[model samples]
Target chain A: MSQVANRHDALDVVGAQWQAVSPRLVTLRRLSLSIVLVPAIVVLVIVLAVTQMWWPGLVAAALLVLWLLACVLIGRQVRAIRYARRDDDLVIRKGVLARRLVVIPYGRMQTVDVSVGPLERRFGLASLQFQTASASTNATLPGLVATEAQSVREELVRLGEKRMRRL
Target chain B: MTGLEPSISDEAASPLQWHRVHPATPLVRMWVALVALALFTLREVDELVSGGYREILALAVSWTAWAVLVGVIAAILTGFYISWRCTGYAVDDERIHFKQGVVWRTERTAPLDKIETIDVRRPLAARLIGLSQLRIEVAGGKDSYLELGFLRLADANVLRDELLTVARLHDRRPGAVTTPEAGIAAEHSSIPVEDALYEPSAVAAQHVLTIPNSRLFAAALLSGEFVTSVGVVIGGVIAVVITGSFATLAGVAALLWGFGGGAVKRFTRNFGFVVTKSDQGLRIGRGLFDHTMQSVPTERIHAIEVRQTVLHRLCQWWQIRATIAGYGEEGDETMLVPVATSDEVLNFLAHFGARWTDEQTIALLVQGMAGDRHQAGDAFQAVPQRARLWDPLGWVRQGHWADDDQVWLRHGRLQRAVSVIELAHCQSASVVQGPLDRKRSLASVEFGLVSGPVSKALDHLDESVAVDLAERSVAEDRRFRQAATAVAGKSGQVL
Candidate 1:
């Protein structure tokens, strides 16, 4: 019984160190979605105007519902996103429904990339990605402040090279 | 520099010069381009014919047409020649470098010590021309290495042996006296240096495993892929009969035949597969139409997976696969055994340095049908009761065993899978808490090995247990590396 109790508290120590990204990520997410969805909605409205069909209106409304649901889900997902730097490994945890926790060793990191789009730049946000040996180890952290992304990229790259030399 | 330069006395001592591939290399490499050109010309001929004989006669008589045709041929020949001439490769003391392209010059180099595997592949056309392609898989992921093609079979083998020797030599200590003297002596010797470098006879010949043809054929017949393909064809034919779509029968038949033939051919390619143990590495040779020889060092293997599909479980058979870096690109290269009984798989895995101390793991695998031992208390740490919501059926049997050498995770009830990841190969560990798991205060611990799609997870453990295991796995990974380095230091060979 003591063993079981000990097992339950293992993660309590780890929860203290996780750093959350910026809250403005929710706005960036909505803006990126609207860029594509707004145009799509316009096209659907145009189709409805020309054809004057009930089905197209129904389809447009359905899409609006989906977009609203996506906004809510993306907000939750952004809230759940957290990154932590350990002694030897970098950990990223995200997702709400089907959660994923990716831990990549510094020694295994081959490349660290920072990408920012026009919309993200306007929102002062950028994404950082690290490529490891395994193809499935998709180590990505999005919605970080642009300055934070740059510092993280540089730090990870430097740390990766140092660990690699030790190997 | 003059057109006719004088030969120097130290030419042999100088760094290896960049050597160009054979002249025929261009033709072999650009065969796809040539085929496209031929098809385009044929289509042009069809248009010309429809335009009538007069146009054809006019084209024949026209000097411009003749000049255009000559120019096109000349342009193609010049391009091929330039591409071939510009591409050159050199293997020096420390690295292998390849330089290619005319306008956009590109140079690629791979450190000699980073080469993970050397494979000699021969396609049907290359085999017909008595040539082979040498692929050097590097430590990094795809697109990080170089592939040189269309070399004479003998030359490719010699170059492969040289690279292997350099890789082995790079791992030794600087002051090791026997290696440098032996290396120099072996270079000058008339016989191949590889034969003298290591004692091949140290590994007994009887230990090597060879799969016979009959077994391969039976395995193919029992495979789920083969059965489903046949069923699809039959189902299509039945639909055609009921719908009376006789006109579409030929097209459907042709498609099915093509698909079925490719599957069968792939299945039978490894009919006489043989794996032999050598001083440098394990040498694998197989395939009927395109014979291939590949060598991978034992220490490079990342993880091992033993899969038993629903059908395989009924027959008490398992398929063993290894997750080797730079191997998962091709489906067949990573396979250890296509199909084998529990005993055979255990025997084969023993050679690869996996030992199952507890017979309970094996018993659970072989005789899981009885269902009596599913809940038996053993050394394995079973998942908590909260896991019943996630796994439900197999929650009792789902457990993890972390011995000194390997960490094994078993899951699933009907189609069971047991992944044995060597402790040494574990690069990192992670604890994942899903929404459902967080509610129950449980988490899953995942061990990240070298690049491969297959993953191993010990799911639904107590949150504390998961984190503890993750930390322990990292410690074990460090210990394994230290142990390997110590062994390599003592043996004077990079195991």
Candidate 2:
């Protein structure tokens, strides 16, 4: 009883093997942001050139600063993401400012999907997504080594099947 | 993944046959899409007619445009026809199969034994066309279901009965066909294309409860919608005072929805609502214009929640809801009692075999007991007085009870509620902490129901208490499941 009380005294503890996502996830996040942001910035700079206004140049600089801030935020967000496999459930901890730890039981899990986008594939990473009975419990573990993601998906499916069979 | 392949028995000697939906189905499904396309085309034609082209030949362009329009219409019709031809459904002895789409094809199947509910829906267009869609709700979750859309109304009803019959028969004996359900299904399935007709099978369900019009009206008046409406109206008045202008569409819409829309929706959905209980399970028949029949078996129910909004609390009324597997956001169907007294709510739960014999209620520091004195007692484990600031009026009411086969939770301030969750049906349990909670060393325990949108909670407990509650609830759930499995192993009967 004392151990249980002490374990949950600190809020951040999930107790065991909470692994952070691959550090390359930061690069993937930055790359995806730049792909969208770079084009928008270029379009804004072109508009500024056409308008030939000093204030517009200031606006373009402000936009560039916003872009840099977004990149930093994305990096922090990717870093904050972590996951752990429990005895009967999977726990995903995410978010920097308003943190959320979603725990999904194996019995409740319906599907374990692996999604890989072109950029993610180029970076040798895949996202493992879990679809549970409840929408809120559903979670995605982004930026895993492709093989690791596959193994996790296989393990989850196996565990889910076993639990459901017992039911 | 579980629903991809159709479930079939080892002795299935009959060849699997594929059949398409009615010819009118494609037209019905794509009518809205086609209408929008036509509207866009009409706007383009208007643009061409109104604009003056100085360098181009207007007469030649007009002729080309007409030709293009004709060709596009022909192409669309051909595509619809091809898509309709490709889409098909079949009834196997062990499963219901559906294959749809042209480019991105999907193959969906639902096992006979796992089928939860079979619904026959008739939309306005389908009604006019004398067609109905047979929706098969299965146990595996949201996406693991099949719909055989736009079959003849009679055929649809027969098909629903057939599937249900097969499922029931399967339940009684896994592979044996001693009953007449499979026989009827087989006979109906073998009917030729031109003469597919079967009589509406009489459903075997006993009349349980029929809500009177007066109670329905009271429920509407005491609903969360009514309270929300009142709040919105006050907010609108405040906004008008602040802005000194009424040029807000949102304000008008909010005002309209708060009063009339909410009341109307409640009245229409619950008007002439009736509940029936049978060996198959419980069925709720509701709706004024859009008549609906929702069915769920007794064992399929995940959890039963009893709530009281502020207005209802003042009136000593309670609303009881059941969360069944595979139902997502469909409110009226699961609501066993819309508005009833606390005693009445207990009686209703008794009818469903989830009677909480021990009466208990914690005295809130503020907003003390409202009504029905005999129904209230003290059984809940309360949060500390230090947590009072977290929920001023409701902090004392935030408590839980875990014993036997049930976990009882009490919460809410002006609108107090006591949600009764069966330990056997709970999907998951966890202790959640936020930044504010961490500062105060407080946490909340949430129990996830198998179905429904939100989790049941005992909010803002001491950190240690929350952890204890979570562990106890999980242990209870595990014990319940283990016992159920043991019973099944001994008797080959699953409850």
Candidate 3:
């Protein structure tokens, strides 16, 4: 009876919440996107002011507008990102207008990598990447709180070992 | 440069003794390149000199020039000799070690178990020199596969068998030695051949399938490439007649060359292909110029596909390819059978444990291929009518079926192929929906397969159905695995 309970426990994903990532993810993406924007704007301004090239100025204005629109979209994109941890699988949901949900079972999990970039570390954020035998099916849960990411990685590693299956 | 993690190397026992490769290993390759280069240089000289062939020949053979060329060749040979000296490898029961480089030192250790497949490959040049290369494939992205080359052919084969025997845990007694040297020396020196005691002398080989040279050639002629080339040639001639400009013929010639070359490559890659079965696993042997023998334990094969084009259907022929965990090159499908008749295909599939010898199953396959899948009576679950909006040509035929643990996806119009993968053996399962799919309340389900003979999806099912399928497959996969373990007969082979 206990073994049957344990077997059913592996399918326990009914009421799991899709936990949202750190809101700072938006700021991180916006900052990174702006890093490229600043240099291009600087060059465009100098080229336009010195050469009096209207085309360069026009291009720069268009790029600035597009970058601002992207900044807005990035905020929504970050807000929409969420993940759920089940007994046997991990579920990732992202996108606003067109949503995409990916479910990966722990049994198929080969490696769980926790990465903290300089910018992410500064913001106390980390990312966890999942690898499987199939190279193309890798999924990443980015912008988790650093400590949460570490604990989740450990939990996943435990589940992966428990649910290990030959590929 | 091709090394494993430093931590793994640390855990491994240090290499016992280093063995150097055969001296002729680098010479054959370098010699070929040098001869090609010399011929090219002579051709260029002949073109440049107004005196043509005679003057170029005289200039090429001038005493000083001849001396310089010979000196260069000598220097290269010496470099190769030093390289051969510097490069060395050592293998133990648990790991293989490679130590190479002079200025930039490098050492690599690969655990015996992580090895996917061990192939004894003999390129034409290497074979001529009685040498072979042992290719060890591990599951890393690129530059992951390691090769030990320029060894005597017998030494390579013995080493391969010995390594696989240990790595696969086929034997517990660690049959001859912990080193290739002892094994090779034992085989070469006229000892009592005690090592042969451990090695299975010979099992009555099961001759599964053999594609004749004539059949292979005929298949190539009926292939899509040849058909396309014929069409292109006819169009090129018609266009030439209409425009009356012969330069347009260049386009036709180039396309023809491309098609013919590809078909010829496919043909030769599968030339004299033969598949045989033993108690251990399947022995796949092919290649005319660089014969390769790949032994894939049936248990290691995760996925398989049987395909037929329109012309192939007319000829009642099919091609079979399989996905062995470490046997396939990263992004390319390995051909298990280039071409075989329906009966041969059925026989081959049976070896993989698919009980499909009956007339009913053959009829099921024929219906699944081209007939209305609905007539199969629950043998397949096809796409809904609305899904036809997505695949205008093949939507009606697109379906998925689960026979025992094997989940099969069937799709394709002009070229119909059925890919069968045991879900329990697959890596992962996923469901995705694009904007269009979302609007239609539909989604696609895909199973993650290791690199080879496994690239397909169950496309255009209801969103709910797709998600439910993906989620349920996880449990089904787990259940099958556990039950399979409990039974655990000679896994991979039916007998």
Candidate 4:
């Protein structure tokens, strides 16, 4: 236990083969952020070019810095997401700063949902959500390779049926 | 998992004999609506005579108007009667089949084993008419709630017994033993009524706890809501006096009404609370005007929570609530007892298969109730000092304890609540950390539970402790299940 405490990944499942999300998720994140922020940057540039005001210049610089910060944060967040299907339970770990780990027995799962946003579709990634009887369970494994997500969903559904439990 | 199948069936394999609810079931509820409709019609007819609508009243010496009103009443009553005629239910060996509706007919089938609760509810009106309502709650959702209402009270009681005998919930083999700490309760036949909590009355089942109506009333007075309501009313009155304003008196009247209504509701809901144990499950009887008898199959409770405010604590009173498998949070039935002595609470816990008979376990449970007193040994996995950042006064008070079968979480500074959840009931587990917890290498853990009053979480433990606790829970759950299966194999029963 002390050794586990000393380890950095102590809160995470240690030996189980962990599956990381598609790195393309980071690109997808950047793309979505760009969709929302690039226009503002463009608008700011236009406003600055028309007026050549010093404040707009400062604002543009600030926007650039903010965009750069978002890029780093999104990359870390996407990379942090990991999930593994252990013998008895499915473990999901995510978050860069705070971190979280969830282990749910397949029998407790009521349903599995797979969804893909336009951005995620462009990046060939899908998100899996597992619903259990408990409302507190927040087991959403996002940014999985599309095919892997489908296979995992099927596997989970099969296992869930084999060990189905009432709420 | 074991009881979900129609196994241990005493139910006769008889052909479906469809039965209709009391013909008056529709009228019980719709009568109120019908009265409202009649009153509105009367106002309209009165206006026709008194106001400018006199021309309409003069058409046929008012007989046409009366005839139209009577026709409308007849049409509505016919609609209700038709609906009553259409509604029917049938019980076969495997499931309950209910079909209702006159135009767009709807049918529902609930597997006998999946029935969560079979409760007898007698609304005041139904009681007055010597009728009762049987509500069969299936755990999945409200859409599955089946109500066979306005049955003769005697008929409802017979049906409730018949359904209880057939429902899979009753087949659950007894012990939901949690961990290594609580030994398997060997004797369940009956315990002596030496404890003061039991009313010294001869009863068929083990007379466990019976709380009187006066105690319920006193507990309500000591309740937080009552205190808050009084405070608000007093504050309002003082404001009116200081401002010399008559307008603010309306707010005071509203406050008074709120206080009186709340008190009446508390009395009606919790009157004559009693818990009894039998071979099958625990029987909870409560309520004043609308009597309810809830048959809680002992194995169905996911967790048990005993709570107290400072005032109630001072009076040595505690309120008991349990998370029955599919009970909605707002349902009055979740309450096991409204007011109980600590001894009565312990007596109740023993009924759930915990080893309250053991001195050490009793100590541990009591310690869990009041929270950390810096006790020696493995009494609790106390929160780390770093938790003080989040809750300075309460950091020392919060704790988590597990004895192979159950997990106990106790926390609070002024008002403390301890929740006892058997390991068998935990469906999932989680370890979470906020940014601050991450900085301190600490995490809080929550074991997933069915929706009810039980809030199972232990915050701010060493990351290692949290992870170990959560992971060990899966192993514990599996071990308990395997042990239960082994016992079942020998005994021809499943836990």
Candidate 5:
């Protein structure tokens, strides 16, 4: 009974960690989209200016600012999100507008890669990419401290390895 | 199968002896330096020749001498770098470890149980240099669990033998035992070898089958008729002035030579093909001067495809390829035979335990002709319900599903061809609609199979039907995976 209770408690922790970490991935998604958008918007504004269209230039600038503001807001919202790991699964719950809860069982994890990008490095953060057997289905737990990401990756790898052994 | 009794002491002892690999040979450094010097010389040659011709010639000789001196110095530096960076590999009873890299160092360690194959490749140059490249392919990632690129051939062979011995020992261990006869291996290995073995060969053979040399020459000649006509007009004028009219003959010779050169290039580049059995599974090595060796372990193959073209049918040739689990070269798809005869293709597929039916051949023809304008009479002769909305020119056909296979045709004012593809082992499916396709109410459904280099697309179907088919294919893929896993479990080979 104690063992079962301990397992349940561990599972609860895993679930909480997964929930805490997932929404933070939106920061990466927003950053990636913005990287593409900013250059495109700049090019569009330049093109409009070259065409001697003052109205289109102003409209493009305004749109760029709005996009920047939206990006900032999304980044903040991502920082606020978090996830936790349960004994058997990882739980990811987030979203300011549309709430979502995702549970990924430990057995499903094929690989856990910890990566740090330039921006993430500035923030002293790392992202853990959880890849499953299915190519299309994967989850990223972003915006954790580097140490936290390492610990989480190691823990997940351990659990995943154990599950693999059981199979 | 012989079950040789393992000696008790052999199990207890370590199977490997570590010997440090030699540094990268002097020849490698010389080769690099020679290329660099040649480029530098080419850049400076004209400038030197223009000013101080004699002095520059002396400078050029001195430069060669300087390059040799620098090469020697660089070789020593590189030897030290390589020796410091390179490490020996050894496999103990349990695991294998390889430590080597220059600046961004990496030490890979994989359990002996995880090892798939230990391959040693000896290129002509490497053989002459007395070195071999050892690549240890594991069950995981892009990185060779261990790669020693410049090891003495003897050392590499010993290391390969040791790793293989350890892997075999690990496999035979009571808890870790995995044998191909365990049922799951049959299905896992068979599907991919079967699917990929035909399609790529068929696609490749099309180049040879369609447009024979005479036809190509005729086509070229026809296309260049304007130029020839202009030449003839010039020759008519020149004939009146010239003693023997040699100019016209010269012009004809040049054109023939140009056509002959093009034909020779096409033939030579696509020469020499052989698909043979290797110790692991199958080896497909082809090309005239530059040979490519592709090895596909029967188990790692996810899918196989056999494709035939209209031209290939006349020649009775087909192409075979595989969609494998791991990525190769540019990306995932690896061709077993770019081109081969039907019998050779069948022999290759037979190695993987798959056979094609007579009905499948007819099915292929039907699939190819379904949306083609050239085969319109045949298309209308036995029109399946799936072809109801198929526009040979501007008809919008959408939302038709035919069992496991789907056909789509894009018929416009000029364009025509049928895309008939299978969707059983599909991994992802999508329906794409461009502005033109949307205006015509036509869409293309792409099926991503588990094994192969290319996704099969059924184009010019009705939008709704395409979407429905995409959804159904994805669902079917999921179902197949489930069935495969269940089948895998019953077979009891370790996943």
Candidate 6:
């Protein structure tokens, strides 16, 4: 918790608080990347076998291992991300290597969904999905504990409702 | 009017309970399912004759399982009839209540003031049966309204008239004088309720266009499966001629026959499309065997598209479709019309309060920007450097000021497209980013419109520019809406 606070303080120093997302979500991120890579590895092996190229198979395996390592490193970095609410907007700052900052105004929020998948369910963790009217633009803050996710969703909804009523 | 009792208060009596009055014959929707089952059985029998005894035995066991399906369908039909008889709706001075469902009965109640629009639809089969379906749309979620299917035609009309009268009376300003009962009595005595409610004057002039049967047939022919089947049939014919393989030829012939049958079924189901102008909105009713009636309000329309295929252009015909709010089972509910002339389109636009300037400059800009060619003209504006780089489709070219107030965007392929976004309707604008978009430093800016349910989006712009433009647009819209609302209030109109 102290480390998390220090990380947030560091993010604030850079004036990029909105780029923060939950650090614990790194587990889910790693799992998703692994799932994606399994099919790619299978396809690569099949292609190499079909071509009867031993060196190509070795190269493909090497690339897969490198990709997996990169993903794990990025996942660990993402796990350190955190977000905070500031006045009428929520700020998310994320990414270890290529950081991103997103500021979503409460009035623009259409729906706030708190979803817990099978793995997240075991860890009592959930993902907060923020939907806006524009289908193309959506923000997700994944890997918060279930209770925290619910609280965030409720806060966002209340803010959104207030904004709608003002309009 | 004199004999009618005063409006009943909700405190005095229970709200009317609505029932689901489905067709007495549930066989209509079930017939296809049954037919499919029977065909499956026949296929199994054919397989058994061809040395697939195990498949035949498995199919026979499944035939018993299908009995439950038949029973369930029959029960549903019976339940529908029973519920229809039992269901009723009542609107008191304050609340409207409806009761429905079969085994698990449900009741819904909402305030009368919450009602936005009441639609009454009569499909071909329902019309023949002298029945109509009534749906009430309200402000909440998609299913906020009550739907009562298969009401007697006369009863439906009476209900519609009564509801309309109540709505009008409730909406009347406080100081406005109520019309004398004598006038009401006179009007009611002379004009039938159906005629009064469904008068031609109540129908808007802009008729929705439906896609023609011939076009649908062309589309079917162009479908992947259709093309593949044709190829297979041609290949089989050539094979038979070259090698005299009777077995292969026979199999191909069967496949061809099945494909033809499927095409015929498709053609038959989509026959006799009609676009009817109704008081609620534009009702696009189509489908031969399985009827579909979709109503799109004029206010909810986002964009209207008029397209002409090469064949349609040669025939001097065009198809018009509108992007509307709300999701339907079939994705976008498109209304198809057989033919629409250019003159007719102008007239339709005028009726819908859309400006149709015949200025050659406007036309030239539309042609030059919407088309692939970059024709140099004094009237034409240059495409923004940011926009040109972002839009790979290159469909969206120059967006320029139109009539000093509106911004016009010209985009589309072959048919050519033009859109005029009024500053008044523009709400919040934003720049969107995806992984790919971030890499390109390009974003999509969406403009939220005030149109009910349906909103239009303008995509692809520089992120910073999009945010600035959106903020400005939203501010302008707010000011415009405020002024418009003030004027409406002064006029004693409920906007």
Top candidate by DockQ: 4
B1-495, model 2: which lDDT tens digit per residue? 344355443335766688778888987787788889989977776676665654235745667766887899899889989888888887766667787889988777787777767666666567678887877777665565677888887777567766665565554441222122332343335443223213334467687777787888877876767767777777777888898988664866767665768787898877787777665566676777555666566656667667777776667776777776555556556676677666565555544643433333223211122322123555566676777787777875777667655677777667666666765556556667777776677877777665663337777888777766555544653454454455445546443
**Winner of 1 and 3 under DockQ:** 3
Candidates 2 and 4, the one with greater lDDT: 4
Highest TM-score among the candidates is held by which one? 4
Question: For candidate 6, lDDT tens digit of each residue in B1-495?
Answer: 010122333543553443344454233324466678768867766966576677667756796647866786677667656756556565656455666555766666655434445556666656566667666554344456666555776676556555654444442322211212222333334454334435443344345455568766765564445766788888998888898767787788788888866666555555656565555455555666545555544433444545554444454455455543232112324333434565555444443433444455335434532344355553533344555555656434433333423444445444444454544323234445555545655444455432332223445444554444444444453343344445446556543
DockQ for candidate 4, C-alpha atoms? 0.43
For model 6, the DockQ equals 0.06
Candidate 6 local Cα displacement, residue B108, angstroms: 6.4
Give the lowest summed-lDDT range of ten residues in model 2 chain B: B364-373
Query: DockQ rank, highest first?
Result: 4, 3, 1, 2, 6, 5
**Clashing residue pairs in candidate 3, if any?**
none
Give me the runs in candidate 3 sitting further than 4 Å from their true place. A1-15, A23-80, A116-123, A161-166, B1-15, B37-89, B98-109, B170-197, B239-245, B249-251, B327-333, B354-367, B376-378, B480-495
Kindly list the per-residue Cα lDDT of model 5 for residues B1-495, writing each as its tens digit.
Answer: 001111233424555555566665434424566678668866776666776679676876787857976887687677666755456555555566555556655555666666655556555556667776766655544543456556777766555555554554454333333332322444444333223223222111111122233433333233334345556657656774776655566665576466555544334333444455543455444433333334444544544445544444454444545555334333312555544555555445556533223544444434332333334333322222344444443343212224543333222222222333444333344455554555555556555433235335555665556655655543443343344446657656334
lDDT tens digits, residues A1-167, model 1?
00112233335335335778888999988888988887888789899999999888888888899899999998898877877777766877777765666667675677889999898899989999887554556577998889989998898888776545211
Please provide TM-scores, in order, for all candidate models, with all chains considered together: 0.72, 0.64, 0.77, 0.85, 0.48, 0.59
Compute DockQ for each candidate against the true complex.
Answer: 0.20, 0.11, 0.29, 0.43, 0.05, 0.06
Model 4 compared with the native: what TM-score? 0.85
Sort candidate 5 into its docking category.
incorrect
> Residue B346 error for model 4, in Å?
1.1
Quote the B-chain TM-score, candidate 3: 0.78
List lDDT for all candidates, in order: 0.69, 0.66, 0.71, 0.75, 0.50, 0.53
